[model samples]
Target: MKNLLKNGLMLLTGILMLATSCNQISDSESGGNGKIVLSLTDAPFPVSLVDKALVTIDKIEIRSTATVSSTTEVTTNSELFTVLYDGDPMEFDLLDLQNGITTELLSMDIAAGSYDLIRMHVTNASVLLKDGSNFDLKVPSGFASGLKIKMTPNLVIESGVESEVILDFDVSKSFVVQGNMKAKNGIKGFIFKPVLRATCQKYSGSVGGKVFENATTPIAEAHVQIIAADTILSSALTDAAGNYHMIGLPTGSYKVVCEKDGYTPVTVDPVVVKAREKTTLDIQMATATVTVNP
Candidate 1:
C-alpha cells in the first residue's frame, strides 16, 4: 500500500487502516480455548525520493478483557499483555511489503474474551536516503511509550475456534519529517509515529482498478488511494501498465482517488467491496498545467 503526499509547506498525512478476519468455528468443541495468530503487513506508500524505511520491533503486548455477571453483581477482568516474543528486535523495511506480502509475528492461545489494545516497542529506527547514505531515525519519546494502537471496540475470541490477525502498519505515513534534512541529531530525523490496527483477512476482500490519462492511455506510476469516512483505508501505486489494487479491505463503501503529478486528480466515491470478493473501479485523469510566478 502507498501513501499519497502533497508538496511544499502543506500539511502531510498518511493513514493505514487494519482489516481482521477469522475462520468458521467447528462444533466439536463449543466451550474450549481459542487461538490467535498475529502477523505484520503494510500497504504501499508513495516514493518521492527516499529509498528505504526500516524499523526494529523488540516486543509486542496484547490485552484481553472479559465481562462476567451473576445474580449478585457484575464484574469485568482484563488480562495484561505478556512477553510473547523475547528475542532480539528484528528490523523490517516496510517498503518491500507491497503486493500483499506478510511476515509472521506471533501466535498464542488464550481464554475466550476481548483483546482490546496492542503495543509494539522499538529500540531503534533508521532510513536509507536516496544519496547512498544511511541515517538513524529518531523515535521522539517513543522509547518510553513505544507505539500504541487502541482497539476501541475490541476483538472477541470464542472457545474452540481460531482467528488470524494482520497488523497493517503504514510505515510510509508513520514517518514524520521535521526541520531540515541535514539536521539528523537536531530533531530532523524521521519520527516513528505509527498508525495501525489489527485486522483479519478471512473477513475482508480486495479492490482493483486501472488509472489512466485517457481511455486508451494508462497512467503509469500514479498513486491510487481508498478512503472511508475521511480515513485512508488502503493505498497502491500503479504498475507499469497503469493498474492498481487494494487488498484486505472489509465490505463497505469507499472513495477511490487517482493522483499523479502534473495531472488532475480523480476521485470516485461509493465504490464498494464485498467479503471474499474483488471490486473494480477505474479512474481517468486530465493533464494540468501549473504556472509559477517568477
Candidate 2:
C-alpha cells in the first residue's frame, strides 16, 4: 500500500511539470517576435507651367535588402504588407536584382534585425497641361520655375510597429506664357493694359471736435472710396476705431473720398500707386450743415 501511494504521487508531479514546461515554451514563441514598417512621403519638385502643357504620372518601384557587413541580420519577406500613396494603394514591382539577393520590402516577427540597401525605381508617371491661354501669362518677376516631383523611396519598415519614408522626383521647369500684353514693354504700353492689383491697410486715429463739431463723441461706420480716373476702386466701412483695408487694384493715381451720415464729405489729394505695390490713404471727414433757400 505504501509503495502504491508513492507511485501515484510521483505520477501527478511529473504531469504538472510537463504542463508548465509546455506553457513556457508556447509563451516564448508567441511573445519573442518584432516587426518592421516602410513608407514614402512628398514630391521632389514643383509643377511646371509653360507655353502649353499636359501630363500624368502612374507607378513607382522600390527594393530593400539586408547587409552582411552589419551586425543585424534582416532576412524576412514583407510582400504581404501594403504600399500606399496619398492614402491610395500604389502598384509596385518586387524583383531580386541578383542571385542570393532577397530584394523586397520586409516585415518579420522575430527577435530583432538590421538591414541595408533600399533601392528605388519610380515609374508610371503622366502629366497634362491644357491650352496656353489657360495660364495667367503675366506672372510676377522672381517667380520660381516649376518642376514636377515624380517618385520617392521607402527605406525601411519595422513590423508590429509604425515607420515613415519619403518618395519624390522633379519634373523639368516648362510652362506656357500666353498674353498679348507683356511687362517687358514700355510703361505706357503696360500701363494701358496693366494687370490690376490693389491692397489696403487699416489705421486708427481719434477724430476730435475739430473734424466733426457738435458731436459728444466720434461717430463710427464711415464710408471710404478710392477713385482713379472715371473708374472707382475699393470701398470700405470703418470699425469702432475707424480702420479698413481694400486690396487688388491697378497701378495709378487715386483720389480718396470719405463720408459719414452726419459728417461732411472729405477728399484727399491724388495718391500714386506703383506696379505690384500697396498705397496707403487715410481720411477724416468734417461736419457741416446744408441749408436750402426757397
Candidate 3:
C-alpha cells in the first residue's frame, strides 16, 4: 500500500507538469505576429542645379499598411507612418505633396495589413530670387507638389515580416533649363543658360565650433548661423559640447556666425560646402565690455 501511494503521487505530479507545458506552448503560438517593415529606394541621377547648386537624391517617400486580427487592438494612430525632409517639418497627410513620393525623404514603420496601393508624389522645391545686386535666393513657402504614384498588385504586409519598394528613376536623362545669354545683336539673347543636372556622389559634411567664456571652456545654447554669401542657409544651437551640425546644404561657400547674450558675436568665414565632404568650422565668442560714464 505504501508503494502504491508513492507511485500515485508521482504520476499525478508528472501529469500536472505535462499539462502546464502544453498550456505554455499554446500561449506561445497564440500571440499575434511581429511588425512589418517597408523600405524605399530612389533612382540615380546626375547632380542638378537647384539654387545654383548641384544636388541629387537617392530615395523618395515610403509607406506601409497592415491588417489587424480581431484579437489585435490598435491603441494609437502613431503607428501610421509619414515622411520628413532632412531639415523640414514632419508631414502627416499621406496624400499631401510635402509627404509624397518625389521627396528624398521616406516614411517608416507600417503594421501588417492588406494595402491596395502605396501612393507617392514628387516635385521640386521652388526657389525665389530676391531682387537687387546681391541676388539673394530663398525657398518660397507652399511650393511642393504631389505627383501621383501607384504600385501595381497591391503590397501585402504579413505579420512579423518586412518588405521593400523601389522608387527608381534616372537623372542623367532628365534636364531643365533656366536663364538667357546675350546674342550677337547684344539685345539680351539666350546664350549662357543654366542647365540643372543630377548626379549621385558623396555629399555629406559637418560644421561645428566652440562658444567660449574669454576663450576658455565651452558655452551652451549659443546661436550659430551658417551664411552663404548674402543668404543665411542654416542655423543651430551649441550643445554642452559646443558642437553643431550644419546639414542638408548644397555645395557652396558658407560663413559661420555665433551670437549670445552678454557676449560679442563671433564670425568664421569661408565655410565651404562640398560633395561627399565634411567641413568643420569652430568659433570662439568674446566677452562683452561695457562702458559707463558718470
Candidate 4:
C-alpha cells in the first residue's frame, strides 16, 4: 500500500486486516483439534522511492495456555511455544500486500485452547529503492529470540472450528528511515523494528469509505481514525483515490474522524460496526481556509 507522507512525517497507518477468504485448503479434521490460519499484511509505505521491502521469516511460534488436566505446570520459556511455521524460510514483499489485501501464510490444526503470545523469527530484511540501490536492514535481536507479540485478550480456538489471526505489520512505523529522504544521498539506511498488531476474526469488523471535501473533491492522504471511549482504536490514511478502509476492528460504535492539514477535521458519531461486516462511512471535510472565490 502507498503510505503518503507530509512534512517528513509518516501519517498513513496500515491495518493488517484479515481477508474474508482463505487461499489455503483447510484440513479435514473432526473434534478436539482446531484449525488456525495465520496471515501477513503490511501497512502503507512510501511507494515513490521504495521499490520493494523484503522480510524473511524463518518460522512462526505460538504459546498456548491450555494445560493438561489443569494440573500440569505451565512452562514460561521457549518450551511453552509451539512452532506454527518451520518448513521453509518465507520471504514476503510487504508492498505486495496493501490496501485491504492479505496473504494466508500458514494453516494448521492444533489442540483447542487459548493462545496469548505469537512470535515471528526474522532471518533477514532489506529495502530496495526505485533507483535499484538496495540496503540491508538491521533486525535487532529478531534472529535469535524472535519478535514476541502478546495478545491483549488471549485468542481462543474452539474444537472442530476454524479461526484466523491477522497480523498487521505497520511498515510505516516499523522501518525508520535515516537521513533526509528528499535530499541527495538522504536515505542513509533503515532500521527494522517490526511492529505487529494482531486481530482475531471471530469478533472483528470493518469500516470503509471515501474522504472528500465539500462532498465533491476526493481528498488523498487524509487521516481517518476510529475512536471508541476516547481511545484511538485504528487509523489509516486515504489512498490516492481518496478511499480509506480499516478492518479487523472489534464490533462496537465508534466515532470516525477524518482530518488533513488543509481541511477541517470531521467526526461522524455512532458509526456502528458489526462483526464480520463492513460499515460504510463517507466523510465530508470542510476546508480550513475559506475560499474567497475572487
Give the winner by lDDT.
Answer: 4
The residue ranges of model 3 lying beyond 4 angstroms of the native Cα positions read 1-201, 214-216
Query: Model 2: how far is 164 from its true place, Å?
Result: 33
C-alpha positional error of residue 252 in candidate 1 after TM-score superposition, expressed in Å = 1.3
TM-score of 3: 0.36
Ranking of predictions according to lDDT: 4, 1, 3, 2
Of the pair 1 and 3, which is ahead by lDDT?
1
Model 1 spans with C-alpha error above 4 angstroms: 1-31, 67-79, 142-145, 179-188, 214-217, 289-294
lDDT, candidate 1, equals: 0.62
Per-residue lDDT of candidate 3, residues 40-155 (tens digit): 21112111112221222222332333333445332222233233232333222111110012332343444444443222222222221122112222222221222223333334
lDDT of 4 by residue, 1-294 (tens): 223210110111111122222122222422377888766665667766889888888767788754323654333366778887776777888777665667777677877777767767778888898988899977785336777766757777777877877776777667778878879877888887676667776677788989887555898878777787886656677777799787667777889877787888888898998887999888888879777976
TM-score of 4: 0.78
Q: Candidate 1 on 1-294: residue-level lDDT in tens?
A: 247200100001123234444333333423556776666666665454568777787766665433322441211122346445557767777766554556666667766666655556667777676766666866656335445555544556678666666666666677766555444543235666666645555576778878888778998878878888887777877877888766767778898877887898888888988877889777888998788999
Which wins on lDDT, candidate 2 or candidate 4?
4
lDDT of 4: 0.69
Per-prediction RMSD in angstroms? 7.5, 29.2, 24.2, 7.5
Off by over 4 Å in 2: 1-219, 275-277, 290-294
| TM-score of each predicted structure versus truth | 0.76, 0.27, 0.36, 0.78
